[model samples]
Target: MRTFNMHEAKTNLSKLIDETVNGGQPFVIAKAGKPLVKVVRIETEAEKPRRRIGFMKGQLKVPADFDTMGADEIADMFEGKSK
Candidate 1:
């Protein structure tokens, strides 16, 4: 990470963005030497989304009544009226 004052960031916004993107580096903008904010690259679409392994592999067990329940019953279930 690099630190830059607000004035420098504003005056050289393009250069700062270029530096950040080219080097995969982040920047922290500060006011009076106190850290304020960070600037970083955005994730590209090709980046695969992370998932928790076995998060639902064997943990999910849908009830037989899952599809048979009416809207009101589903709402009541969500509202804690049904256990």
Candidate 2:
């Protein structure tokens, strides 16, 4: 990793970013000889595999009455009758 002072970093910001992105090399930016931040490239979505639909179709289950399970208490809360 190469170290770039504040001024040099600002002067070649785009070039540095390109090198990091294209060549996958990371560099450090410092101030007064003290390391401040590291610049690196983020992976694009294209590099990540996409999840297929219904990939876990049978991995989960829900009760048939799940929506109505909380009916009474939910209604009481809405009517300000539940504490």
Candidate 3:
């Protein structure tokens, strides 16, 4: 991260933005010597990685009674039963 005062920030707005987006560098604009805002790249969907299906196959385990394991408890909760 880089810090720039208001005057410098205004003078180099375009360059700062370019550096932030292309060079993957971030910068902070300050007012009264206090940090104000940050400049950063907004990643588009295409730039993001897609999660592949079956990527975690066999990494998890399932019990034979998975479907019915929580059915009774859920029904009781819905029927106003408190335990």
Clashes of 1: 0
> How would you order the candidates by TM-score, starting with the best?
2, 3, 1
lDDT of 3 at 22: 89
TM-score of each candidate?
Answer: 0.50, 0.53, 0.52
lDDT for each candidate structure: 0.87, 0.91, 0.89
Regions of candidate 1 where Cα sits further than 4 Å from its true position: 47-83
Give one digit per residue, the lDDT tens place, for model 3 in 12-75.
9998898888866889999999999988888777667788999989999989998899888899
Query: Candidate 3 lDDT (Cα, whole model)?
Result: 0.89
Ranking by lDDT: 2, 3, 1
Better of 1 and 3 by lDDT: 3
Top-TM-score structure, candidate number: 2
In the range 1-80, model 2's lDDT, one tens digit per residue, is 89999999999999999888897689999999999999988876666777899998999998999989989999999999
User: Candidate 3 — worst ten consecutive residues by lDDT sum?
Assistant: 42-51
Once fitted onto the true fold, the runs of candidate 2 whose alpha carbons sit more than 4 angstroms away are 47-83
- What digit string (tens of lDDT, one per residue) describes model 1 on residues 1-83? 78999999999989999988887589999999999999998867786879878777777887888877687877898899975
Better of 2 and 3 by lDDT: 2
